[model samples]
Structure formats: structure tokens, C-alpha cells
Target: MHQLTDCQLIQSPDDQAAYTSAINENPANAGTTGRTRRKRSLFNYSKLWANGRTLKIAFLDNPPAAHKQKIIAAASQWLPYINLKFVFVDDEGDIRIATGNNDNSSMLGTDALLIHPDHPTMNLGVPPDHADFDVIVIHEFGHALGAMHEHQHPQANIPWDKPKVYAFYQNREMNPLSKTQVDRNLFATFDTLSAVHTAYDRKSVMHHPVPNSLTLGDWEVPINRRISKKDKRLMRLLYPK
Candidate 1:
């Protein structure tokens, strides 16, 4: 299974065990300064409705009141920084959220519009304590808000140990991913995903915590629970006055 990342969501086929990890970070905070555009641009164009302005979201099967409230709160954290508003609806919406056992995923921005309405483009896992809960909710919402994983930034220079990285996910207890899957989800990077960006922010909510064991040298990021300073800065840049 791919690790827990801010955004690298390609819903796994696993229905029971959330074949998602908690260590994966996808930052296609890619190189936009040159030829690249922004990680979100790597995907197809937004379906317009999902491109700026008010964006509507829905919860499939309707989570419990408490869970729903928490989801709203976590997702709304970005509202103050970006010029985006999230409206929770009962009918067709720009983004739809579903629940899985331990997996959390989301389609980046308007990509959700292409999927069938009956299918969920976003999946939230079982809620944890405040820290994990907030991180998961906000990170997934970050994808909904057009932010990609920060680790995948083309300029992100993370020194990963191939063998150890492969072993880490394949041996996971939940939805374990194969070497190929791990490579695609974790070691993958984008080419032309540039936009208003900050220096590669290891603390960005889009990044996953890399354990020291997974890297060759002394490289690692702890499970980041808060949105980094640059994250807000980039959001403002993406939706400025």
C-alpha cells in the first residue's frame, strides 16, 4: 500500500484494508519557475466549477455528525488563506468524500468531476486523535484545494534508500503495496507542475513523515501535523486578490 501522503491518491482496489500508508508524501510542488506549471497542472484542466470560487463537497453514506463536523473543521482550515469556500451538500457536488477502514485519499481538484457520480473520489479513514485526525482531514482537503504532495516536488531532494523504502511498505500490516506500487506512489515525481511555490517545505501538510531507517543518510521528516508556513503562503499566491 502507498504510505500516508498529503496527496498521491489513486484509490487502491483493496476494500477492507485501506491499502494506504502514513509515510508517503507527494509534493509535485513541482518546478513551476521554469517550464513547469504547478503540480495541479500535471492533471487535466479543472472542470471549471472546481476551479476557484465556491467549491461544493459531499459526504457519501453521510458520516456521523461528530465525524462530519470534524471533517468540516479540518477542511475549512484553508478557507481563511485561500479564496475558496467549501459547501457541504447532499446532492451532486464538486467533491465527494467516502470512508474506508484505514485509507484516506482524494482526487486532485476537478479530476473528481470526471469520475462517475456514484463512485467516491475521496476516501477518509477511521478518525484518530486530534493530531492525526486534523492532519488527515486537512491533507486530503489540501488535494481538494489544488495542492499536491510536497515530497513529489521536482526540486525536492530527498535521499531515499530504494531497498529500505520498498521493504517498508510491502511489509506494512494494512494494505501493503508491492515494490512497483511503492515506487510509483512514493518515489514518483512530476515534471511540469510549477506554480507560486516556496522552498521545499518539509513541514508542509502535504509531506509525509519519513523515518530515518527509510533513507540512506540522516534524512527524515516527522509526521507533520500542522500546515507549514509556506503552505499558507502558496495558498494565498494561488488565490490572491
Candidate 2:
């Protein structure tokens, strides 16, 4: 079994501001209908970037050259499927990366704009030497590209052993998560609109590795290292290049 790393999502501090930023960056984020009435609904907006735009990625904390190259390579895997471009830089960027910790996380899409520019929007805390480094990078970038966790898709129907699942994350030594965090990240399901209408894909890199121990019966989803076909299809639908 692949060792699971703590992959938490860093949401913008202010939902309203994040919504405004997302809609302003991409009008499609407001959805097709009810653009006027749904503006007040926190859950109605999508956090996608403007199609065909170039996203500048900046590295903070000055990680090793090799590390930066590996990150760039891993994140680039999504390029062929999407309409957007990525330009890595040393200065300020639309997506800021920081390393040197174990709690890997990223803000969902345009929510990065709501964060302090000096702070990192994404944390590549897993060391480059880790076996799943590339997978983790790809996963974070999936979030940066507006992909939500596949396990949270409303149609997933995972048979989770809630008590054991909660205990495992809460008691884990490295980057322990609270019950609320576990509920939000693991148990909460995404509505169809926010989920982008793709069927739940267990093999998607956007999914967390579900250990059999935390689930009822023999159900388990191993760590997904690469983007799945469904992932590509979903990206194509969202970006339509």
C-alpha cells in the first residue's frame, strides 16, 4: 500500500471575496443560469481560471533546482488536457509554492487571489525524495486547476467506516487532522455542478488513497500516480481546447 501523505485543501479565508475573484477571473464560474440571483449563494460559484490564460507559478523558500524542475515536470502533465498555460518564475506568481514541511495542500483555483500574496497558495511539503512526490505535485496542481477530490463526488458512494476513518486521521502523528477537517475533506460530498458532472473515478489522481482499513469490507483505492482518462475528459470539457 502506498503511504498516505496528509493532503489538506487550503480554502480562501473569505468565501465572498473568493467568489468575486473567481467570477471576475472567469465569468463561466458563475454558471450558466441565475447569474444575478445565485451571486449570494456561496456554493454556486466555480473557481476556475480564465481559459487560454497563462498562469505564473512562483517558487518561494528557494528550493533546490532539481526539486523545482521535478515540480514543473509533474505539474505540466495537465497542460495537454487544458487550455491554460503555465509560466514558472522566481518573482510573484498567480500560484505560489513553498516546501520544507509534510502537510501538502493547495488553494482551489482562483481562491489563491484571496490569500496574502507573500504567503504560499500551495505547499509542496513532501520532500522530492519521496516515492509519491510527483503524484502529490500533480494532485495539488489538479486542485490549482479547479479539480475537487474525486472521493467527494456525490456519486462516489464509498462505504467508509466513519468511526475508524475519523480516528485514523485524527490520531495520525504527522499532520494530524481534526474531526471537522476530516468531515469536510473526506465525508462531505460535492454537488454535481461543483463536481463538473464527471462520474466518480477511483483511479483519478485527484482522489485520496483509500486504505481498506478505514473502509468497510475489502473496498480500497490505492494511490493514483497518474491522471486518469476521465480526468483528461473532464479537463477537456472544462477548458475545451
Per-residue alpha-carbon lDDT of candidate 1 for residues 172-228, written as tens digits (9 for 90 to 100):
776767988886777776442223345678888888888888887898898888888
lDDT scores of the candidates, listed in order: 0.66, 0.86
Number of the top-ranking candidate, with TM-score as the measure:
2
Q: Residues 1-241, candidate 2, lDDT per residue (tens digit)?
A: 1244468777777878988999999988877665455335687668999999999999988899999999999999999999999999997999999986556889999999887889999988888888998999999999999888889888899999999988988887766778998999898987634475678899998999898999999999998999999999989988888
RMSD of 2: 2.1
Total clashing pairs for each candidate: 18, 0
- Model 2, which residues run further than 4 Å from truth? 1-5, 34-40, 192-196
TM-score of 2: 0.94
Residue 107's lDDT within candidate 1 is 74
Among all windows of 10 consecutive residues in model 2, the one with the lowest summed lDDT is 32-41
lDDT of prediction 2: 0.86
Alpha-carbon RMSD to native, per candidate: 7.7, 2.1
